[model samples]
Target: MTADRDTLPLPPLAPDMQAVMDRLMAEDGVQPDPTLLPPAEGRAKAEAANRRWNGPAPAMARELIVETPGGRRAFVFIPPSDTGREAILYIHGGGWAFCSAATHEGAARRLALATGAPVITFDYRLAPEHPYPAGLDDCLSLWAEREHILSGRRWSVSGDSAGANLALALMIRLKNRDLPHCGLLFYGVFDADFESPSYRQVADGPGLTRGKMQRYWDFYAPEERRSSDPCLTPARASDEVLAALPPLYLNAAEVDPLRSDSEALAARLHALGRKDPFDTVPGVVHGFMQMSIWLPQAEAAFDRAGEAFRTMT
Candidate 1:
């Protein structure tokens, strides 16, 4: 009973966003060339999703090759205005399986302009193919090579969706290495259990859906080691480890299932006096930033997030 890829249903989506989703589904990418990684294909789809995005004139943002002792990884560099050169290591979100430096070009360019920080956005390895630790390694290597940027400096870290998850994983990794952190998240996933209150309350709402999330994890989480690693799912990590993370600016869309992941984690951090900044954007849905015109509330949310990222660092 094998199913044809072309016939697969598009995931349940937000009504406000249905037209865009329909258009995206219509121009479906040919199955990727074998030379391309699965993550690369996912990124292509995201770029196609916003084919009309002619974002701000970036000061300067371009693809870069970062060669580290660990390995060669790709990044998109958005240089800050020379007036005051701050830097942010930006991670683009997917469910740890999709999106990349290319998929998130608009957000990166706009973010650089808004925060006035040179942005280095990475294309971390995505999973079930790359699996755990591979993507994590790429993420940490980008930061380790830039310690001068992160140490007691105004260097901030930010990402949306699964990249947000990677950001937190990097914080934990940095702490373990006895390094400093400046991590922020936009509509992040902080838990793996997925049964938190927000999950139940917003599961059927616009944007992200429970069934779709399950599919995302299916593609991202390899069978052999899915539950054992905290890198893939931070909620499974102990509270002590989660508390030691750096000051964070976490946001959630009002109708996003991950909203509770943000709320619960923020509460824990607040209780422990981590005092991270967390916000719930009104009238927004999961992955709203991908279609700002379709989800106007996201622009304001992103603006507020930029402010928080500036201050948190």
Candidate 2:
């Protein structure tokens, strides 16, 4: 459903960010709505569009792929030099439908550089194909095998957009078991409520419109389950569960429709007396970090996220 644009004006894009956006638009041309394309076509188009932003890949000291059951593939990026025993499980975001480890390799490598930790990113099953518990279960499966995979290194969890949503849900599922050291979530889709202030303000888009997000939700979760399933809409998680979450570093893009998701989650955490750090990077669109190769603000945001991860208790 198309939402009427709210009178609230969006913040302007950073100059560098605008340049990158313009370059992408020129290359990709005016594209059809993602929800209108077939799943295969959508995935192909997304991968192609993202390929340009990947830039020059940073040199990894070591890289390897681990194959698990059900044909799931996990990529490990080990930074050069002695980094330390800490590791990060990086979940790539593509609205729970498109993108994969290869698509996010550049960002994951940059994360490894910034945090001085090996970053592990995997191909979780996508939506309109796998959906909901299928993707979450894949993440859980990797966590289950962490002992074997991480080689006794201390680890934190990090994700972007839909991946961030899965990261939080994974933490919720593991609350009864062992927990990660912390969580670094970026511009996450925490709720299914598309009429939130940010969504209404940015209903159409320079990027990440409310309509596309609504379609993504439909692909990932049935309407009846969205509000009821804590794993699907983590904003609906109980206060107890929220309180039990590990130290978190949350950030949102100023011009994103999902910005309020991070804000609302941060506010709720504050109400519960937790002081997780939340940042809103101004003058950028949703998933701006993907352009870190060419955008100074995006690169700085990664540095900020790494610093937060390092300082979190």
Candidate 3:
């Protein structure tokens, strides 16, 4: 799909999503700078946008901050109709740079409401300051310390964008350990390759672009070690590692630079005999999950994902 100079270029978006995109373009503008900003400011902007896009938090939900190992804290969302045992460990995406559990609370609440399970999200250290392995270490540390409690009934690992990358990486890291029952990856970054067809086709985008993603990678994983670290780039995982994963549910935005990542990963999984379900959300852009309140496609994607979660758990 072609991008427009003054507006979001491409095929017509879902009627409901068109309005959400229009509002986003009007508020944040068509072209993004893609430059790294002060972490605090980036977080503030994300929080404000999340506030505007997501409706009020669903009622009968409880939120708590629990201390994890290494003095880090984790955020958890418990739905009103609590089952008390099952939960999902959701990781938020901000290119591994910005955004925290707080900024992404609305999406967490929506996931809990849709799946009928509680959700837990944590703050991993951001990059360009903490760099590679820092965020992953935080997640692993917390999981190691609290997996028993979190694994009460059924627990799965789920995330979007960089968060999805981390989720897959965690599975690879703990492949021999007690892995999650399933995974839900939404428009993730699986490889460092910038020349994929989707990247070339959507180089300049309505939301995320190839150049912006490259900048994110550079800040998170330096050029010297990125290619060698499968954890940093899950696509680099060997066939042996890919074959050991649990059931996965993946979805890509029809018009997104990272669209190819999901396709490629699905192909890899298929080749390894893990023919899991992979889907695409047509007429949407990156970060569409956060727009569930306004975009029908986003809600539909979540509903499909909820079904996958239910079937696996």
Models 1 onward score TM values of: 0.76, 0.95, 0.90
Whole-model Cα lDDT per candidate?
0.66, 0.87, 0.80
Worst 10 residues of 2 by lDDT: 1-10
Residue-pair clashes per prediction, in order, are 0, 0, 1
CA lDDT, candidate 2, residue 165: 96
TM-score comparison, 1 vs 2, better candidate: 2
In model 3, the Cα lDDT at residue 212 comes to 82
* Candidate 3 displacement at residue 217 in angstroms: 0.6
Candidate 2 per-residue C-alpha lDDT over 33-67 given as tens digits, one digit per residue, 9 for 90 to 100: 76779999999988877766677888889997876
Scored by lDDT, the top model is: 2
- Model 3: weakest 10-residue lDDT segment is 1-10
Per-residue alpha-carbon lDDT of model 1 for 198-256, expressed as tens digits? Answer: 66666554557665566566666654555566666665666778777777788877767
- Any idea how many clashes model 3 has? 1
TM-score of candidate 1 versus the correct structure, residues matched by position: 0.76
On the 0 to 100 scale, the lDDT of residue 152 in model 3 is 56
**How well does candidate 1 score on lDDT at residue 2?**
17
